[model samples]
Target: MTTITRILILMLIAVVSPIGAQDFQGIATYKTHRDFDIKMDSTKMNDAMQKQMMEMMKKQFQKTYLLTFDRSSSVYKQEIELSKPQVGGGFQVSFGSSGSDVFYKNVKHKTYVDQKETMGKKFLIKDSIAPIQWQLQSDTKHIGEYICFKATYTKQVPKVNLNFNSKPNIGDENEEEKEPEMEERIITAWYTPQIPVSNGPAKYQGLPGLILEIHDGKLTVICSKIVINPEEKVGIEVPTKGKEVSQTEYDDIMENKTKEMMERYAPSRGSKDGAIQISIGG
Candidate 1:
């Protein structure tokens, strides 16, 4: 059948079928993966070492998240797992979002509360949800048992500079610094109307249905399983712990911290023995 015909049939079924309880709630499990390629100086690092590093990076990027939602509110959080010891080289790198952070969204109020911890400090980021202008498409696909419709949004995001070198750059002192570049990216989401809830993993929502899959840049989030109305009702609580701050304030704090780290670990001039250079592409 055509996509339009399929949608019509689903709408008919929904009209004829008996409606469930009014207090709708569900738990969705999502698996996330990012595709990245790392390049390092061949002279400093051997093929075996690079291979080991790639394996470690892969483990870091592969993570799972759980979203518990009622009718108007939802809580999305990463699944906590035991940290494994870093092997291979003596160098260890830890980056990206923390596993303990919690994201809470209230679609009815158009607000979000993100509880995050960084630099041994906890912050509760409270802010209004930035509206996304989604262009709903007629394309349809089946994700597991649910038929999903496609939606897309375009936005400009900061371009990532992944070149890292343990060698200081020697440039003219009179040269002016350039502003950070921005690039446009299209975010694609596949939502299932069967769920009939405006909830999704992370900060993405505002859809007519629950999002089953998302393609944001190089990262992909796919719902692996969903349980609707379990025996024990899930409680959605607003986080109270941490110093409250706006989303912009939290972003500024993180940016300053990152700059500090870069300055501290930046390589000195005339360094050769332990110099390491890495470039990443996605």
Candidate 2:
């Protein structure tokens, strides 16, 4: 063959078979840790007139979540943990995905206490559930060499409508007029696609990369390390529950019980045990 013909053939091969394809089946790792101050919204609390200076203390609440993704099969596995003190607690959930459908198993642990109240008997318990619907929210962006993406996701929490029994009642059937205190924490997550997994620790997922950090205002959960695409297939199991109840009913029960407990435990007229007490009618 002529020299020109040889050059043309080589050019044709180069054009057809591109060199160095993207690594769509490799593992990615990420880790980050930071501190945050926690407090209730001033707008939600009563007694706005008396501005109380809240102190900032170091609260140790950390978590570790492990994730494994297989891009070839589109399946992912996650293990989450909650590490905290006696007053506060943590929970864990395991989830995996096959195609568009996802499956989950959740386990949560908390300090348990039972007592009687005006509303009824109540229990303070902890539980966790997993494998909710999660989708990719955005494309990957580069933060230095590492690609990242900010994706917003949601978890449908049960309605929490708890009445405040600690407040004074005007009359019978007048409870509706009084204002109740409650708030629904709508959670959103930012993930990175560098990991290429649809699974995240707790209820966080659906970003272009691993979730380095997440906050629901009150408590913040961050990823310390993420190991992606392990060679062996990981098994995710649904955890056994110590206390089982739907998300909606659980909040409702807690609210009523807390209010009743406050009323009974707190000093009403002139006792220091209550959250607020006033000496009157002496």
Candidate 3:
């Protein structure tokens, strides 16, 4: 059967289902993995050092997150874990502070509030949820015990320059630098009607059912486990501890910060660079 037909059936089932307590909550565990390729100056980094860097990057990007949701609202955050310090060549590799941010979404109101921390400053990013025009596909699959249907959406995102060569080109200083071009990216999601909740990990929502898996660029988020109406009820609270800013303002700040960081770490002309450079692409 087509996904749209299944969705209609699920909606009918939900309408006729018995109404219990007003408080209905669920907790979903999601594991995320991102693939990255690191290009470094071979002279500064040997085979062993490169392998170690790759391993560290893998560990850094492989993370688990928990989504606590009700009928109208949800909160998504990373599950923290303690690990031994990773240091190489007098530099320490650490996870981004944004990982600890709390992302709260209200599907009923089409709003989102994200608590973000960057450069020792806190910001509350409040904005309307950007709607995704998903095209439901006829393909179906199984995620654990749940049957999932495929849906896809295309978006334009800033293109990331993955050219990690630190060397300067001749006459490159005279050329005017252009803004990063936008590229089309397809996001694929697998959602199950069995759960009957319009929620997902991170900032993804608005689907007919709970999103069990998502493929966006190099990152993949998959639901590991789900508990419905657990013994402990989930409470989602809006974050209010940061300076308020719109999502676009936050993006501008981050983009400038990234440019500053790149300039700071960029190799100086005619200098012996011993630092390791790692680039994580989305």
Stretches of candidate 2 above 4 Å error?
A: 1-146, 153-173, 177-188, 207-210, 229-235, 273-282
Instruction: Quantify how close model 1 is to the true structure by its C-alpha RMSD in Å.
Output: 3.4
RMSD of each: 3.4, 13.8, 2.9
Candidate number with the higher lDDT (1 or 2):
1
Over the stretch 1-282, how does candidate 2's per-residue lDDT look in tens digits? 454654454345434432224333332232323343324334333444112212112222222234333332222222333433333112121111111122232212211111112122322223343343544343444444334444544554444332233344433464574454545555556554444444454445433234555555445555544444346546543323224445456567666655565466453465433232211010
The CA lDDT of each predicted structure is 0.80, 0.37, 0.79
What's the lDDT of the predicted structure labeled candidate 1? 0.80
Q: What would the per-residue lDDT of candidate 3 be over residues 1-282, giving only the tens digit for each residue?
A: 765687686677556544245668889999998887657767666788777777887778788899998888999988988877655464445554656689999999999998977776898999999888998887888898777878899999888655455453434578787777999999999997776677798888878788999999989999999888889786799988799999899888877776667677676768775655544311
For model 2 the local lDDT of residue 151 reads 50
Instruction: Name the weakest run of 10 consecutive residues (lDDT summed) in model 1.
Output: 273-282
* Candidate 1 TM-score to native: 0.88
How many residue pairs clash per model? 0, 8, 0
Cα lDDT tens digits for candidate 1, 1-282: 665775686576456423356787899999998877556777767888778777767777789999999879999999998998765464565664677889999999999999887766888999999888998787889998887889999999989755443344434467575687999999999998778777799989988789999999989999999888878987999987789999899888887776666666666656665634332211
- What TM-score, over all chains together, does every model reach? 0.88, 0.44, 0.88
Model 2: lDDT equals 0.37
